[model samples]
Target: MERAEEGFGGGGILRQPPAVWATAGASVVAFMGIGLVDPILPSIARGLDATPSQVSLLFTSYFLITAVAMLVTGFVSSRIGGRRTLLAGLALVVVFAALAGTSDSVGQLVGFRAGWGLGNALFVSTSLAVIVGAAAGGSAAAILLYESALGLGMACGPLVGAVLGDASWRYPFFGTAALMAVGFLCIAVFLKDQPKPARKTSLLDPIRALSHGGLASAAAAAFFYNYAFFTVLAFTPFVLDMSPYRSGAVFFAWGVLLAVSSVLVAPRLQRRFGSLTVLGGSLVLLAADVVVLGYGSHTTAVVCTVLSGVFIGVNNTVFTELALGVSDAPRPVASAGYNFVRWFAAAAAPFFAPKIEEWSNVHMPFVVAGVAAALGALVVRVRRGSLVPAAVEPAPERVAPEGAEVLAG
Candidate 1:
């Protein structure tokens, strides 16, 4: 294994190469696209004369396609090479986001969002593998860099949405398209193509990878946690009843806390508490927070919403590390398998949250989210032994075996 030898001690997190930084920057933009429409959901619904459930299909279509596309990311990347895969993904996002902005109906927007998700699936699944292979510090630092980008992007998405969506719901779409174009340019100029895996992955590889007990358990738990996670991200804006700017502002605050905790706090916590313990505790806490948001007063709900970010942040880092490390499968295949399972929940959350509200009440959706989070914790608790090794030792770094393009040092 040719791991980057940089130790975690000192300022390792800040010591990445230019290519890693470029990939991280592009990752931030890719994640930003996830929540960019959060502040604008209500506006889109009203403008297009669609109901909440109809508008929520934006998340459903996007994540549904993303979830399905996860199955193919490894296959595509193995064949096309990482740089080409990333560029292709970014190009798709640029084209689809622009088309989404021009859409006149909610249906068209939903369809375009599905296209965006395909691009996202390709970029996100490959980015981590690329970082781990080329990063200056060790695998841990690379994971942190990736998570930092996720947190920062998640934080910024709603703010951008709120600002642009205030003027017109369509503007956020254009904004995203433009920003992704910049990301495309950045990757094109700075990132060299990564070596392909020794063996080209098949569509079945991710599924086969999940046969490992640890990987399967982690994926299952993440399935439930993602249900809770997306509930907060996709459902709360409608419940907040605030203007787009106000909703964006609230989510922005939440995202800031998420970013800080993921990049800064999670590593410290993992070092002290161990990853499984930290992950279980965070999932439990997130469940409790969702319960409070569901049952509390409006002011209390707002506070709980912001507070959930902390728990979500911790879980994201721990889970990513676990998924990449727990199985013998290659990082890209394992990630694809893990994501394929989890993102179904992400797709389900937004689509079902509103429909559940219609069937019961606003509070019930959070109640279900709370239960899902608890289940995620339970999965971790039961599968403690398999997951523990990942916590106790730093993951052994492995580069693509042979026969792929290697970046120049």
Candidate 2:
């Protein structure tokens, strides 16, 4: 089997076709919705006269629906095709995000967020498959491109949120709606309809895909890792106790580190040490960072929180590569399966973190998150054999097409 090189020295990353760039542009806006609310969480609570825990349900509703909706994304995309799926997802996001801005109560906002999540599930899952199919270089290059969009969007989400949200919390939602509308238009204008897969995916296909040991192991590890990831994302705003602009600045810096490491640094580390080693070590460091963030002084916590982004960036790239390559199931089915398992943690972390703080103390949630990060590393170690050897090995000088390489195995 031809292995994918971990390096991007050939300018492959930048030499994408116009369709790829257009899709990537839309992807950036879609991912921005993930962190767009971080800078405004406190403001939302105050504006709506809700508590931290109540406000945290924004993540809960969004990710819970997202997790469930993952089961149906493959089914939808396979039938309607990628372009329509992408367009449908974008339209829903545009509508629901606008509605969320108009929400009068926390409950109303949560419901709108759930609608947004459903849309996100359709777009995000399909976007990966679309990029992999249409991208010029190979699956590795496509995955890196996707991560770039994720990192950039995550980095910018807070800055935009802070600026707009400082005026009113609702402004960020409206801003997201507007941005997504632009993305919708771009995709509508620029993207051609993708050819449907030979086999249409069923709702149960993703569940069945998890029966594969490698895909299952990857998903399990990602589930635990996501707990730690979302803790920083959803919980730290309250802990930092900074003004919206300051918190936005902090997370913006964090997102820059995340983007840099993901696009530029992770491949180098993977090339040197291999993907599994890089991932496991990064998780360990992330666990330590979480511990410090939980117990250290405020200034230390702030620094560690930003530093956690480096580890997160590396893990995101490696895990995504693994998820796409590990299973015999089609990319869409495997991705759906992987996302279905992992996003539950994304939903649970934000909901439970604040409540955990309220019940015990502010520090306990981070302690739990740290433990979860450690367990993620453990899962990777324990299941290393089941994962594809190619993922951990350096690429050969001559690489085959992604489809040919997978078939050769």
Candidate 3:
């Protein structure tokens, strides 16, 4: 048939063609390349004879830049178009990946990694826009797939890194670079950006649009979820390290299983229960997961760690979908804004959660997850009620997203 529809396909809730899926798959590989190096940073620093305080900058820089970059990505996507932004970003990652593999000092490594974060911001923001644009039905299913890819990448990172590190720590970074290049090639050759929007989106327009009710709530939830996740994920390896385990095997396994579960079932779950159900149930599971993991026993610790991934993956995907659908604002900007807050919270988690964990136990971070998830669920309940519609509600006057024509009653 003719290629896909103009401008990908539908609205935030819309779906794209098989080509979009392939592009998304490549995007995941690019991201996994980044993620693989992150989990082992502490060990890498030690191997390079660097200090822990200095090494921490690797994560801090990435998240800080990512948060700021996400805000800009939305506006840029509107201006330059999502396809170009994502493709360019993937290419940049290839360059940074090679640079990272060649670092002579912690300073150089940190700086190169910072550049990598910029590329990530572009990939995540535009890829999200593309997936949302490409969706055939609603953004929820597409968004879930994106999140699942993220989980898959995240899962693969540490497992691959651990194996590579066992051989030579440098191998991980080098292999990651190779992966990034491959991902770049895949996107450049296959994925195509749709035509730019007919209207020019002003610099301040997205900020003004997010002033709507559901949009703000969705943004808030995304921010909190990120904080919750980063807190646990950032700390877990340290926690596992403290145990008698030989190395970071536990955290690595946890990531692998989380990614597997998210990929294997997230779309089906979204199709069956809808975003609200997934969000609510996932929040509860997260609370339970954190509590169990926090207790810090042998069997309990491992089980809890794995559950954290499972709940967090499902929570993030569902929340992303909710953010896209619940908003009365436009889809692309809405997704970008929500991710902006999410990454910001993630950026901040390391700076803050340590003190809380010091005050209580490792479980304290999970407590935060429980609270954040609860707040997110409350927002969803108040805003969307449920993903399933028992009755019809009229579309609002605002129509910023592509699906609006279908929604406008």
Candidate 4:
């Protein structure tokens, strides 16, 4: 039997190695890239003399490349090792982010963002596997720590964007480049090259892993959920129509709730109701909140927008766990597969939301997001039996798969 001390309840979540801390700190910066442009979207549109939809392509191009690159991340990381892959990814981000700042046109900005996405895909897909390998206690603890970093990065990204972007839209891009350079140095110094897999993962491995029922179900659900998630992230700033500071402050509040709920609330809820149940319920709530956000007054929109963070936080945690453990595949391969399937929606949402608004009314996009969230809930409900493996408690002392270690030494 697993010892109680090895579990998340044992305070193992707080007792991580220097390697984990460094990686986590870097992860905070890497994830900051996701929302760093939030407060500056309008600024970019106006600065480049572009429309909102055109500026939205920044997200579309980034995530589109990110989704496709998911297939190659495991392939590359498995060959060169985790530490090298991480450094390479960080370097790419540093270059591309700096280049993005110099873009004189929306087309150039979108092109640069696509390069950033490729780097991000490599980093993000590998980071979870590294943390899970190096972390003490169990995979659960590692996952929680990862989620915490995500929340904190998300919370800070908009504020950074607002502060730097308030001076000029170009500043946020340069700032991201500088921060990622620091993250690159930290990773280079603190993280050793992880053990390579006995067998190199093929590009097709992630695609094949989707043959498993639980993994497929989880990926499908996440696909729908990501649409709503990104819609909130990408579209709501326009809805708010506030200054960079006010928008930053609002998203900061939302991100704070996201962090708090994912770290503090999600585990307790999962322990009681199980992961799928919690995920399903949270999706339903998100669906309702989004629809209301669409129809409500500005005050109502702001409140609902902040509240959506809680549901999003819960879903993020649960979905990540499911993607990692739902299949018999290696953790990195499984994650790659899962992300490959779901990130398409991340690409789609930003593109579609504005187009939908342009075609119909402003409210219609939120309604579409609500439907997507509801569809995510439906997938969870319909596929509940298949997700049983992920719903169970992950065993303590779960070791990294062959060749996927992120050991500090």
- The sequence of per-residue lDDT tens digits that candidate 1 reaches over residues 1-409 is 1221233454566898888888888888888888899899999989999988999999999999998998888889889899999999999999999999999998899999999999987887777777767787566677656666777788898899999999999999898899889888988888888887778889998899999999899899999999999999899988887899999989998988887776567767977888898999999999999999989988998999999888887788788778777877876678779888988999999999999999999899999999999999999999988887656655434322110101000
TM-score of 2: 0.90
Can you write out model 3's per-residue Cα lDDT over 1-409, one digit (the tens) per residue?
0011222344432345765676667666755654565457667667778754466566667778876775677667667887788877777777776787788888887787778888877876567557656666555556545655666666666667777766666777778777767766766666676667777555565566567666677677666666667656665555555321233466556666656544444435766776567766776677667666767586777678766777765665455555566555566666656666667776676656555666776677667766776776666667664333311222211211322111000
Report the lDDT of model 1 for residue 66: 91
TM-scores, one per candidate:
0.89, 0.90, 0.75, 0.91
Clashes of 4: 2
The Cα local distance difference test for each model comes to 0.83, 0.83, 0.61, 0.83
lDDT of 4 by residue, 1-409 (tens): 1222344577887898888888888888887888889888988888899888899888899999998998998889889998888888989999999999999999999999999999987887788778877888777667667766777888898899999999999999999999889888877887877988789999999999999999999999999999998899898888888888888888888888887776567767987898888999999999999999999999999999999989988887778777777788987678778888888998899999999999999999999999999999999999988887777855423422211211100
Q: Model 4, 240: alpha-carbon shift in Å?
A: 1.0
Ranking the candidates on TM-score from highest down gives 4, 2, 1, 3
Task: Work out candidate 4's RMSD over C-alphas.
Answer: 4.0
Model 3 clash pairs are: 11-403, 13-138, 13-139, 14-135, 14-136, 15-134, 15-135, 15-136, 16-134, 16-135
Poorest 10 consecutive residues of model 1 by lDDT?
Answer: 400-409
Model 1, residue pairs in steric clash: none
What overall lDDT, based on C-alpha atoms, would model 4 receive against the true structure?
A: 0.83
